[model samples]
Target: MKMMYLRRLFTQELCPVTHTDLMGCLQHSPQQLQQLLSGGFAGAPGLESLSWLHNLAPCFPLRGDQIQVIHEPQHFYQTLMQRIRQAKKRVVLASLYLGTGQLENAFVQTLRHSLQAQSSLRLNVLLDFTRGTRGVANSKTMLLPLVREFGEQVQFSLYHTPDLRGMTKRLAPPRWNELLGLQHMKVYLFDDAVIISGANLSNDYFTNRQDRYILIEDKPLADFYAQLIERVQEFSLAVSADATEGLHRNWRILPYEGTKEQFIRLAKERVTNFVQEAYQRQLQRQELDTEADTWVFPLLEMGQIGIHHDSVVTKQLLSNCIAGSRLKLATGYFNLTQEYMDTITHKCLAQCSILMAHPNANGFQGAKGPAGGIPAAYTLIAKSFYESLVRRQQNHRVNFFEYQKPGWTYHAKGLWYYLPNARLPNLTLIGSSNFGERSVNRDLETQVCLVTDNMDLSQRLQAEADRLYDLSTTAERDIVQRQVPRWVQAVVRIFRNFF
Candidate 1:
C-alpha cells in the first residue's frame, strides 16, 4: 500500500509538463565543433545517458584517445575475454540481456573461469529486469548456477525500476506503466579500463545483432561509468538487508515490495521530478544550439524535441554531412526513416556522393533463426529500407552500395563529407547517438562531433564508406503476416522519421 501511494503521486491522467519553454530564445550552436571533426564516430548510450538521471555531468565529451572503428564482434568479444582472463582483484558486468546457448555458455565460462581459478576474485553483475521476466528467462536461471559454481566469487541481480511492471500488477492502484520506456545500457568496467558498447552478451547483439564497443582508459567518462556501476553495487547491498530499488531489487530477485498506489506517487513525484531537474540544469544549457565565426556553416534545423526541443545541433549534424560535394558515407541499421530519406535524397542531388558498408548478414553471424541465420522479421524490414534508399539514389547519379567483408559488423556511426578540390578534410562524430528518433531524443544518448583538419582520418573513413556504398543487391520484402505485411518495414521507416 505504501508503494502504491508513492506511485500514485507521480502519474496523473494529465498532460506532460516540461521544465523549459525555449521557443522565443535564440541560442547559437557552437561553431568550434564544426571545424575540429574528422573520421567517423558512433555509439548508442541509452537510459543512463539521460540528462535528468541522477547526478550527471553538466556536459561530457564522447571522444577517445585512439579512435578505432571495430566492425568485427570477435575482435571486441576476444578483447573482453582477454580482460576477464587477466583480472586480479575484481570483475564487474552491467547488462540488459544475456541470450541463449553457447553464447550463454561462453559468457559463463569467461567469468566462472576466473572465479574457479582463484577463490579471492570478486565478480559482480547488475542486469536489467525488463527482459528477465518472460521470454526465455535465461538471466534468471543462470544466476544460481553462477553462485553455485563459483560460490563466494560470483554474485548477481536482475535490476529493475522499482515502480515498474510485474510486481506492481497485483499491488493496489496498479501503476505499472511508470516503468515504460526505461532503458537497458551495456557496460563493463574493471581495473582502470572501461569497455562500453551497443552489444549485449546474447548471440543476437554480439554475434547476431550489428554492434560495436570502445575500450576507454582515461578519466571523466570512465569515472562517470565506473561510478554508475558502483551505484548499482550499492543497490545490491541494500537488497541484502532489504531496501531494494533499481539495481538492488533485481540483484536479489525480490518482489515489487511496494503497492501500485505507492509506485504511481513515486513515479510522478520522484521520477518525473528527477528528470525535470536534469533537463533544466544540465541538458538545456549544455546542448550547444547555434554556431558562428567559422568557415563551416552552423546547423539550421526544425522539428526539434529533446534536451532542448527544436534545437539546431542534430539538424546541423545532418545538414553538414548531407550538403557535400564529393563523398557522403555512413553506416546505420540500414533502416531508412522518411525524414532521413528525404534529407539524404535532397543532399544527393545537391552533389553529395553517398556510400554505405555493412552487409545485413554480418551482425547476425552464427545465429539460429532468422535475421541472418534464419528467416527473421528484421531481415524483411532491412530489405525494404535498403531498397527504398536504393530507389532514391538510383534515380540520381549518387554512388551507393551494400559493403560486404569476410568478418566485419560495419558498426561505425559517423558520416564523411568531401568538398570539391578544397584541401580541407572530412568530419567525424562518435558516441551512443544514432540517426533514429530514439537515438536523437527519446533515449538519453551522447555523441561527440569533431571537424578536424586531419586528412588521414577523414580520407580513411571516406575510403571505408566507399566500400559500403559499393554493395548493391535486390531485397525481398515478403512478410509472414499480411495485415502487418508492411508493418515491420513501416516501423523501420517511421522510427527513422519516414512515416
Candidate 2:
C-alpha cells in the first residue's frame, strides 16, 4: 500500500510530457489530479510548489506537416522525391537498406536533383551494411557518388560491423571488429523537420508491399537528433566504437572514423543495449497505486524484468487496470511477445477492446526485385501469418481490428492504452521501434514515450486507428476456402509465431 503512494510521489517528481521534471501528480487532491491531467503537456505548475512549471513550456509547441497516413506506392514515391527536391541546408538520412534496383535508381534521381540545385546543401547518409549489400554486391553504390560529387557540400558513409561472418561473440574482449548488429534507425532529419520511422530509405517503404513514415516538425526534436548526428561524425565510431562521445554536447567533436562502417557498428552496439534496458525499465517503473486507483510507469521499462543484469526484457506488459481496456496497437506485424499476446487474450476474454494498424503484408523482404518494393511471393507469406492467427485464436474473445493503408504507407509505431478515461493510459509511445523479433531483439530502435491527457493528439491518433482497423482483414477461413496448398498451410502453422 505504501509502495503505491511512493510511486505516485516519485511520479510527481518527474513529468512525462513537456519534458518537465514532475514525476506525476503525486499528492494532489482528486480535484488537483483532474486539473493536472487536463493541463497541456508542459504548462503552469500545479499548486504553489510546482509553480516553476512555466520554465518547462518552451517558446512553442512542436509543429510539423501533419502528414495524413498514406498507403499507396505512388504517394510514397512522390513524398520521398519531394523531400529530396525541396531540401535546403542539410539533409541527414539514416536507414537500414537502399537496395540495388530501379527503385534505387529513381531515388537517386531525386537526390541528384537536389545536388544539381547547387544549394550548398550538406547530405549525410548512414546506411546499414546488411541492407546495403544484397549478399553479392556493395549497396554503397547508391550514395557513394553523391559524397564525391558534392565534395564539401555532400557527404556519405557506410555503417558495418567488419569481418563479422557466421556467428561470433558480440562482446568477447570487445573484438570491436566484427560487425554483428546493424544500425536500423530509419530517420530523416532535415533543417526544418525530424522524421523517425520504421521505413528505411528503400522502395519497399513506399510501394504496394506496405510501409509507413511519419514526419515530426518539432524543432527541438530535430535539433536534438541533429546534434546526435554530428556526434557520430566527429567521433570516428560507426563501424567500431561504443557511442558518440558526449552526444548531448554541441560544438564538441572527438576523433571520428572517416568511414561510415565503423560508425555503424558502434552505433548498433550502443543502441542495442539501450533498447534492451529501456524495455525492462518501462515495465517495472510503475509502483502499485491502489490508493489513487492507478499506477504510472515509463513506456520503455528499464530492465527490472530482464533475464540477466544486462539481458533486456522485451515482453510488453499489457495493462489490465482500466488503462489497457481501451487499447490501440499499431505494428507492421501481428506477432507479439508471448507475455503480451497472452495478456491481450486474457483481457479480451474479460471484455476489453483492442485495435491494430497492420500493414497489408506482414513485411517479409521479398526476392530481389527489379523495382524493389515487395514481390507477390512476400505478400503471400504475410497473408499466411495472419490467417493462422485467426484460425488458432478464435476462442480468445479478442476483437482483432486491422487498419488499411491508403495511397501511402502508415509507419506510425504506437500502443495507446486508454484505460477508464480513454486518456488515462492515453500514454502514447512514438518512435522507430517495431514489435517484430528483429526489431525487439536484433535491431537498434528508439522511440519517444509521451503520456498526456491531451485530447487533441489522442483524438487524431484514435480516429486514424479506427480507419485502419476497418481496412485490412485476411481471415483463416478465407485462406482455407481459397484451397491454399497443403505445403503452404503447413508453413503457416509452423511459422505464425515468427511474424
Candidate 3:
C-alpha cells in the first residue's frame, strides 16, 4: 500500500498543473498549499528521493515530532532561556558574538545560574576571535566573569581565521579584519536538544531582526553538533580570565604548534578525517529508523581551510532541481557567487523565487562610514543579477522579492525546495550561510539539509516560507538599477567577493 502511494506521488499524471513559467508552474497559492499539506499520507515521496545526500554527509534519521520551528524572535529567546534553565548535562553555544545589552546580560546570568544549580552541567562556547574581541567591553569581556567563576566547568574558544595573518592582520582595522573570514556557524545545543539559526546571540537577534530558527530535540543531532564544536575548539584559542585584573587579561593560543600554514594544514586534516569517519560509519549502519520521516545532512564549508563539502552539496542541490519544481531562496545578503547565479539562471529548470533584504531593511542600513554603503552595494549586486536573468530570458521562471518589514531588519538565509505540484517543501537548507562568495570561498560555515517526508513538518516549512513571502515585495529591475550610488557601484565592482 505504501509503495503504491509512493509511486502515485511521483508520477507526472498525479500533478494537476504543468508549465515552464513560475505563475503557470506553481498554480496553488500559499493558502491552497497550506490546506493541501495540512494532513495526508505519513510520508512524502519527494523527500525520500533525497536520501542520496547521505553519501556526502552523515545522515541522521528523525521523527517529525522531534522538530520544532520557532517563528518569533522573542519566543526564540524565551525558548533558549527555558532550555538553559532545564539543561542538566551540557549547553554548547556557537555564534559570531554575544551582544552587550540588558538582554545579553540576562542571557549570561541565565547560563551562570544554570551552572550554579546543576553540579554536572558543562558549558562550551565558541565565537569568532575578531568579532568577539572587537570593543573594550565585548563578547570576550562579557564571558570572562563566567570563566572566573566556574573555571573549568565553563569554557570558551575564540576561532581566529588563519587567512588573516602577519602584515594584513596587523594593518587591518578592527571591523575591517572580519572581511577576511569568520567563524559563522550558529548552533545552540542544550543537552539533547539543538537550536540552529542564522541569528547571532545579539540584542537585535533576540528582539527584531528576522531570521530562521529550528529546535531539534534529538540526542544524535545534538551529539553530532557537540562533537563538531569540540573539533572546532581543538583548532581555536582557549579563554582565561586573570585572577585580579579580571577582563584586562589577553586571551591567545596558537591552535597548532607551528606557523599559520601548519595550523591550516593540521586543522584541515582533522576536520576532513572527522567528516570522513562519520560518513563511513553512516554507510556501515544497517539499522536505520524505518518509520522515521525526516533525515538531516549536516554540511560544513571551511573554504579557507580547504573543506568545501557544503558548497559541493549546495551546488548539486541547486543544479538537480527538475523542471516544474519550485525553489524559494532567502538571503540577508544579495551577493551570490557567480557559480550560484549561473546555476539558477542557466542550469536549473526549477521556477526560482529569491527573497533578499531591501536597502532600508538591511542590517547595515544606518552605519556611520563606508559600512553604510553596504546596503546599496547589495542593491547593485541584485541589479546585475536581475540583468543577467533578463539577458538569459529566464525572468519568467526566476523572480526576486525584497523583504521590507516596517521595523525589522532582514537576516534570514536558506533554501526551500518543493517538488512539482507539491504544496510544501520536501527539503530545506538552514544555517548561517548567505550563499555568497564569502560563504563559498572564505568563511567557516555549516548548514543542515533537512529532507522530510512528514506532512506535518512540511506544513510548518511551508507556513514559514509563506510568512516571509507575505512581508516581501516584488523586485522591480528598473528601481534596483536606479537605487545605487556611483561610489557604491564602483566599490562593489572592486570588492565583490568581500561582500
Candidate 4:
C-alpha cells in the first residue's frame, strides 16, 4: 500500500506550482506580474485573499499549542535538555556535524543517562557521513562509544552524498561538490515536542554563536519530522565503528564510495514525499481556526536541478508570508540570489528589516588579515550583497542591521516577521535555510513554517527581534557607499555562487 501511494505521488509531481513556472509567468506577462509583485508575494494571483490562508491553515492538528522563541543559547540548551529528559517514547537528533567539545560531551552523557533510565525507550541519531568521519582533535568521540554502550537500543544513520566519482571526480575540483552539495539540516525531535534551529550540537552553537531557536509542542509536527528521519535512515548507511590498529583515535568507520546519482535520487524522493504528505494532510482538515488562524507546515528543499529549481517549497511559503506584508529577515551571512532579490525588492512592503553579520561579527572569520585570505575574502563577499542593495537604492526600503558582541559570531538564519503594522508577527521561518545561493541551489535544507495565533508567542518573538535590532547599527546609504577594493570586488564576482 505504501509503495503504491509513493508511486502515485511521485508520478503526480506533488508541488502546487513550480518556481520555473512562476518565472515563466513573470517573463511572459510583465504587466500582470508587476501588479502581483507590487502587492507582495502573498498577494500573488492565487494566494492574495485571506481565504487562501483558511484553505491551507487547517492541515496542522494542534490548537493554541505552545511556541517559544529562545534568543539566548543558555536558554536554548536548558529547554533542549529539559525536553530530552522528559521524552518518554522516542528521541531523534539530526545535525550537519556534531562538533566535539564540553557541550558535546555533556549531551552524550545526558543521552546515555536517558537510555539507561528507560529500558524501552528508543533513540536514533542521523549525521552527515563526510563530516562525521572527519578527524578532529579534542572531538567528543561519542559515536562509536555510544553504539558500543547501547547496542541495539540505539541506532545511528550517516548520510553520505559522495562527489562525482571516477573520471568525473578528476574533472571537477576536489572541493566542488563539498561547496555545492551536502546534508545541512539541523533538527531535534523528542517524542511530541521539537526544537528547530540552524545551530549544530556543538559548544559554539550552544553558547557563543548566535542562532534562532524555536521550541514547539505538537505531535503532528513531531511525527512529521520523525517520518523524515525514517526516510533518511533508509538511504543512510548503518555505520559501526570498532577499535582499529594504528589509528590515532583508536576507532574508525571505513569510508563509503557509492553511486552518487542513486543517493541523490533517494534523497530527492524523501523531500518530495515529505512535501506531498504535508499537502495531503492540509487538504484533509478544512475547518481550521478562523479567529486566530495558525497553521504549521514542513518546508524541505533539496538542490537537484529539476527537483529543487522547480519544487522549492520554502521560497513558495516565504512568498505567501510576504504577501501584503512587510518583512524582517535575519541571517548570519548576507548573500542574496537574484530570486530573493526580486522577491524582496519588487514586493510591495512598507519596510524591510534585514539583520546580518558584519565582517567583524563573523565568529569563524577575522576582519583584519591578508586581503586574499579566506576570512577577508568572505567578509568582502558579504559586503557585495550590501553593495548591490545600496546601488539599487533598495537600502532605503531596508533597515539593514547586524548583531554585535565581541568574539561571538552570528549564525542565525530565517525570516522572522512577515507582517506590516501588527503588534506581533503572524508568520516566522525557523531552521537551517540561509539567505544565499548555496542554500537555494545546493544544500539539503529543512525548516518549519510557523503560523500562529498565540499573542504571547508573538510578543516573545517581537522582543527577540527588538533585542537584535537594538544591538544592530542601521546601514544608512553613506555607510553602504564606501568603495570596496577593485581586486576584492573582482574576486567576489567570481565566487558569488559558492557563498
Against the true structure, whose lDDT is highest? 3
How do the predictions measure up, each by TM-score? 0.54, 0.59, 0.88, 0.79
- Error (Å) of candidate 2 at residue 79 is 3.0
Task: For candidate 1, report its TM-score.
Answer: 0.54
- Candidate lDDT scores, in order, read 0.43, 0.45, 0.81, 0.62
Query: Model 3: per-residue lDDT, tens digit, 1-499?
Result: 2222212222211221211211232345454333224321124444544534643557777888899988989988999999999999999999999999999999999999999999899999999999999989899989989989998898788888887777888799999999989999999999999998998998999999999999999998898899888888877877876722111123233632247777777777667666666654553454445577888888888888777777777887888898789999999998899989999887898999999998889999999999999998888888888888888888899889999989999999999999889888989999999999999888888899998878899999999999999999898664455667789988988998987
Q: How far is candidate 4 from the true structure (C-alpha RMSD, Å)?
A: 7.9
Shift in Å, residue 70, candidate 3? 0.8
Tens-digit lDDT track for model 2 on 295-347? 11212211111111111211222433332245555665544544455455543
lDDT for 86 in candidate 2 is 82
**Two-way TM-score contest, 1 vs 3, winner:** 3
Model 4, runs deviating above 4 Å = 1-58, 136-140, 162-164, 167-177, 241-259, 285-293, 304-306, 309-324, 348-350, 367-393, 418-420, 476-488
TM-score-better candidate, 2 vs 4? 4
Better of 1 and 2 by TM-score: 2
For model 4, give the 10-residue run with minimal summed lDDT.
Answer: 245-254
Q: Please estimate how well model 2 matches the true structure, expressed as its whole-model Cα lDDT.
A: 0.45
Best of the candidates, TM-score: 3
**Which segments of candidate 2 are over 4 A away from where they belong?**
1-73, 116-119, 135-138, 161-181, 229-317, 320-324, 342-397, 401-413, 419-427, 450-459, 474-499
